[model samples]
Target: MRSWNIAGTLDVVPAAERPDLLAEPVAKALRELGADTEAGVVEIDPEVADTEQFCETYGSPLDASANCVVVAGKRGGEVRYAAAMVLATTRADVNNVIRRRLDVRKASFAPMADAVAQTAMAYGGITPIGLPDDWPVLLDTAVAEAPEVVIGSGTRNGKLLVTGELLASLPAAEVIDGLAKPII
Candidate 1:
């Protein structure tokens, strides 16, 4: 497997060599955002793609792992979508803060099928970096300031190591305070 050390840990390689499983839209967005330099992708055992397993297998700290969740909100018959990124130890404030931010009556995690179809990314591998332009990407202030964090690479078999600044620089990325609450 190819390897390089831009961020740390994981045998990451150039994003251009990203796996075919990565959606085209995600690859295009990564290129357009110049995230290739700030982030690197690494292949992993697909069986261990979940946050807990991946971190344990790769020896990365839990605090350095981030998760991106797709949420849907509706108001007056209009539906809106947003991607929320927060540290794995925290939970996105979907019902309250996110609903208020989306100006919707209700907000909840998007159905698995809808999220996969809309983002063209695998169910457990959505990342904030390449979200659709129209969808607002709400990034928790904590995640946005982390020195380095690992996020999904649009494919379950791959992961990306990136800095908070890199993610915040993506299109439609908005750093929000209290976007996530402590899991405890």
Candidate 2:
């Protein structure tokens, strides 16, 4: 397996070998990706699953971590949902870019209950992988170009380590140049 650029005390192993650490959807998705995939997973404390806490507790660099957020918009009584993947160092441009892409008058983070229910993933561990096929996945250019990134494993107890190229190639993924803005 190729070495990852991730730092800290993470002990990442092939994701396929640790199905127990992943949620069903995540595991199923990885399985569908084939056995030769380079994705890796590391067990983590569920308490620190949030980006900032996870980075601090696990010693992972903020820039090397990615966050997946679900956004929702409504038009003509129909709801549209999309997932955005961005680096921990930045934030998704939900109000502008995502709202425009979704072609809705307004866009905002989906309610936690709805997000968790629809994604069939834990709230603090929603990864872009295994999202509903109908939901567009917006990939921030920066996250898609990173050498390696730590993202949610569909469960708070683990995180997945993968190359940005892999994430960009996911189903329904659309790489956007400025999908995220650096936090100031």
Candidate 1's C-alpha runs over 4 A off are 1-9, 19-21
C-alpha RMSD for every candidate:
2.6, 1.2
Report the C-alpha lDDT of model 1 over 1-184, residue by residue, as the tens digit: 2233333456667677764635577788877876665567778888988998988887878888899999998888988999999999999999998999899998999999999998989989998867888999999999999877888888898888878888888769899999999998
TM-score of each: 0.92, 0.96
Q: Taking the tens digit of each residue's C-alpha lDDT, what string does model 2 give over 1-184?
A: 6666674787878888888778888888878876325798889989988999988987889899999999999999999999999999999999999999999999999999999999999999999888899999999999899989999999999999988899998888999999999999
Superposed model 2: Cα runs more than 4 Å off: 35-37
The TM-score that candidate 1 achieves is 0.92
Q: Return the TM-score for candidate 2, rounded to 2 decimals.
A: 0.96
lDDT of each: 0.84, 0.90
Error of 1 at 76 (Å): 1.6
Steric overlap count per candidate: 0, 0
